[model samples]
Target: MPGAVLAPTSAPGYPAHVRIHEVGPRDGLQNEPATLPPDVKAEFIHRLAAAGLTTIEATSFVHPRWVPQLADAEQVFPLVRDLTGVRLPVLVPNERGLERALAHGAREVAVFASATESFARANLNRTVDESLTMFTPVVARSLDAGVPVRGYLSMCFGDPWEGDVPVTQVVRVARRLSDLGCAELSLGDTIGVATPGRVAELLNALAAAGIPADRLAVHFHDTYGQALANTLTALRHGVTTVDASAGGLGGCPYAKSATGNLATEDLLWMLNGLGISTGVDLERLVATSLWLARRLGRPSPSRTVRALSHQEPRE
Candidate 1:
């Protein structure tokens, strides 16, 4: 029942406002071992909206065989689709996935791509070029339908199979997605091995390739506890959009070594201290994560959630 304490002073030169692209429903739940019922998933999203998260990744349109946890995307989406002033984006792996999302009235969609051939093969069963080929039409068609598409470039920092990824390689794939009409790209540190300097390298290289910071989002995992450092580096360089999951509930099923996405509450706590507006109620968000932790049968991995919820978060 305790609340979060904001930082006493402000930091300099960070974005005045950051758009937290909430991925708790889709990315967070997809990696869970338990498959929550559609209604529970919808309620989770509703809580996030009530906590003032404007952009939420609701679900994925990928085949059920790929991610069984999110198989009920169709049924879960409608429950929160009518929420006002919220942008719900769904993950669409390919054209078929896009079709599924469209049929269910999805207004925003995202395509997942890998920066290395190893991840492209393991995650999507395609080579790097082949996966891009698959996404080309998906992006084009989504734009044609007036639905904005977000491109997820996973393994931007390091890959378990391929080791460190070169900045140029990421920029190349990112430019391809951007050229295909993706309105934004979420650069992912899939294995959470990114250092602040490496993050700076990629962002700089992408800028050199004509990909602006405004059109880029940073998605980092916490395997090495570097997600926050990597994210701040991106923010310092003028990137405003960040992808985070509630309660730090996520890991890549395809890449076993990966950890949870950056915790939304943890990120909110830092931004609040820095005086960067995110429009999220930290008290409500801590409460929401505590609400979900009970459902997941474990305490949240997020430091802020645990600290604010008084460790147990139950009276």
Candidate 2:
């Protein structure tokens, strides 16, 4: 994009290399209205890896009743199982989902929890504590099988039903996940209502509570166009892992107020300018997103994609 803002040299507290945990294949596509064929989904994932995404969330083992789009997890997993040099993690809501993922040879998996009561009910159909209880065994068994678990705590900032979630509430849920054998916790701005100050406050709280910055990741939605700003704040606080989607694809079907996850291309734009290395090739990444946009029959919501689409070739 022509208006790219370059990251200043020697920005304080920013990591040299940020690990981008690409969630496009799973979280990005799960909310789409049309279901992509298993093979297409597999190819999309392959392209993401080709664009230098090392950790790509492949699919979810969620029941079709909740997310019908990813019901073919069994079919999709095997198609991309043999891809070398990439870590493919699947979403496992409970023990059954974990079993399904294991049956297909998944090595890494993620469990999602909510930081707010209303989100816990709407998304998981259970209270916050109950949902965490449900994941206890799932996390335990997955770790026992030599698989690492990623815990996702959604609605960490603001909830659609309950506005302005307390920082303590988020820390409570995040701590539980960390203690439940989860190797890492991804705090999510599910509704994109988080600002930079709030992000700093939450991270400080987590740090003060003995949660190391390395064990946490940030997943932001662009509902209010603050994803990048919030992410900058997270980086300033020492978060090295970020969750993003190609083509800006995703929204919470359960939480209607939410929008797409932060676009991988947009994040790359800022990261690249700031001298942060993510190993992603920006041109290849944009091409991959554009290809996906064609499949979804819409233009990408990414500003970088739009800017590059209209730009003249550089000499």
Candidate 3:
């Protein structure tokens, strides 16, 4: 088991202790061109936990045909199954994926649904409604097995093919996921086109629909450089959970126009500056991202990582 320690603190317009759901191992690496071995993936989780990330998304149980990078979920889960103080949630697109995750004694699982018809078709080969319908049983069986489920709704702000996605449409899909027993729902701005105002509007709508801010998580991309700003807006609305990838290592393979997710280091930098406690050690977290960046044969895309790497050493 890795270390689980954090310097306690708080931030403005945010919860005293925000839950940073580290999605680097799964969501972050899944889009990388190179396929990281299961052992490497497990080590990444261990490093993240050592850096004090409590909820690390470990892997996806979706078929290799879809996400070949995480095809080794079975092998990956066993290596980090005993890590203390960390929640390893695997993504399961359907019942078959759920069964695979459960076979490995998974305690938490996530299902992804798209908010727009275009993204739904591009990513899942189904309509948005159909994707949600498919996840109903997946969520039900996971809950029945006593495994808490997290739901991801992508393209909540805008879609490349469809143009602007109305807030009403996003709320509708969100409500369905809430009704389906997802303990938490992560709203994704898949294309990084969302502004802070739009984020606030969406959260407001979800709140009005009986979904509390605590039940929602925000996942933003830095495409238009709005991820951090949108995240701050979400925090102001009382969204405590946020999804970020270490080293900023992900882009939507289905959405070619999309960029990488908000970097965990960048998010941590903001949280730390605001005195928001995420239970994550900023310096150690940057080191972990630097290590992973070496394995991928590229410099990290995170601004904080770049800045820190170039800073003059203190005596």
Clash counts for all predictions: 0, 2, 1
Q: Across residues 69-182, which tens digit of lDDT does each residue of candidate 3 receive?
A: 988999999999899888999899999999999999899999999989988999999998899889999999998999999999999998999989999999999999999999
What do the candidate models score in CA lDDT, each in turn? 0.91, 0.91, 0.89
Ranking by TM-score: 1, 2, 3
Give stretches of model 2 more than 4 Å off: 1-10, 311-315
Clash-forming residue pairs, model 3: 10-275
Q: How close is every model to the real structure, measured as TM-score?
A: 0.97, 0.96, 0.94
Clashes of 1: 0
RMSD of 1: 1.6
Kindly list the per-residue Cα lDDT of model 1 for residues 1-315, writing each as its tens digit: 345454536778798899999999999999988888889899999999999999999999999999999999999999999999999999999888999999999999999999999999999999989999999899889989999999999999899999999888899999999998989999999989999999998899999999999999999999999988888999999999999999999999999999899999989888887889999987787788899888888889999887777644421
Screening candidate 2 with a backbone cut-off below 3 angstroms (N, C-alpha, C), the clashing residue pairs are 7-273, 7-274
Candidate 2 structure quality by residue, lDDT tens digits, 250-280: 9898999899999999999889888899999
Q: Which runs of model 1 end up more than 4 angstroms from their true locations?
A: 1-3, 311-315
lDDT of 3: 0.89
